[model samples]
Target: MKIALLGAESTGKSQLALALSAHLRNSGLAVHHVGEYLREWCDTHQRTPTQDEQHHIVQTQIARVMATPADTVVIADTTPLMTAVYSQLLFNDHSHDDLALVHQALFDVTLLTGLDLAWVSDGLQRDGPHVREPVDQKVRHMLSQANLPYQVVYGSGPQRLENALFCMGRQAPQWAKQLARQESPTRWSGLCETCGNGDCEHRLFTGLLVP
Candidate 1:
């Protein structure tokens, strides 16, 4: 199954994804961790492109990952929603059409790691010419408006990782546990019914189980 960890900058998304991957691996599950595409693409191109280009690159990376042949879990650090937020801020315009495309491109489950925890500003550089708070709020609103299936994870380090794990496991236990099983040779190359139909939000995030 594919899972995405999304949030604002310096919110520990990458660290959480890495920790979750390790935890799942220790439990004997094979997982493919997909890092942030925007950063990687920027490095490859040797120059940061406009927000529109970044949005396109994010979509392209997600499509590539979805098409990849993997037996177990595929955990993505960010998704198209984040790109849409960046686009909205940079372009001073938002499109329902673009948002629809992003909403349709996401995985069955998306876990939104929040910025409620203490801010660790180290290693956090100015991402292009954008400010942080506006970008963070834009992303939060995008996820909320899309009505995507997501859980708010709060904390730092292991606490944050544990919170994310619990949220994802609760929302998608079947898919999460399936990682422990043997990998299937056949991959889901095309978009699943849930992917294109926009119905995954209802089925995945409804009825949260309080621990």
Candidate 2:
């Protein structure tokens, strides 16, 4: 199973990818995690890059995803579609090859990370909280236009993981199914009295963002 984690900045996409990979691996499943290549690029440069630099990042990300061994499940932190969205959103450059490649790319499932998660600023290339919704809309638009199989993951903490596992079908663990059955998630306050990610919802097999 190839799972693509798609979302805007600070939507928990990266963290979810890592968490899922770890979970599956711990379950004795083979999993390869495709890290965000842009992080390495930014770490090396010490600043955001120009439009030219973005092409390299996008292409590198695609290459990394492609190079991943897919005999087993592979979780991508962010797909090239995200790079295309960022390209259009930030540089206003949509003609790049990355957009075309991402549109053509296929995945067994694409989990659209909800914008209603805790925001973590990486302090360099990260955008502010205000752009989260708009960028999320853009990512959803791309997925819709491409006619991809996707679902919105709309919670944090355990609920968030359960939603994703449910979308993954049989790939989900027994515990994940149990959790999904026990708790009904709704759109919670961005922060909770105890768990900041409480009161969220699960939106599987949907085109909408679950809003």
Q: Judged by lDDT, which candidate is best? A: 2
lDDT of 2: 0.69
lDDT of each: 0.62, 0.69
- Provide the lowest-lDDT 10-residue window in model 2: 192-201
Candidate RMSDs in order: 10.0, 6.6
TM-score of each: 0.70, 0.77
- lDDT, candidate 1, equals 0.62
lDDT of 2 by residue, 1-211 (tens): 6788887888888788988888788777788998887777779888877877777877787787778785877788877777777778888888663464453366777788876666888877688998887888787677667666577776678767766776665334453443343545433333322121223232221323445
Any idea how many clashes model 2 has? 2
Off by over 4 Å in 1: 95-106, 117-131, 176-211
In model 1, the clashing pairs are: none
Model 2 / residue 124 / CA error / Å: 0.8
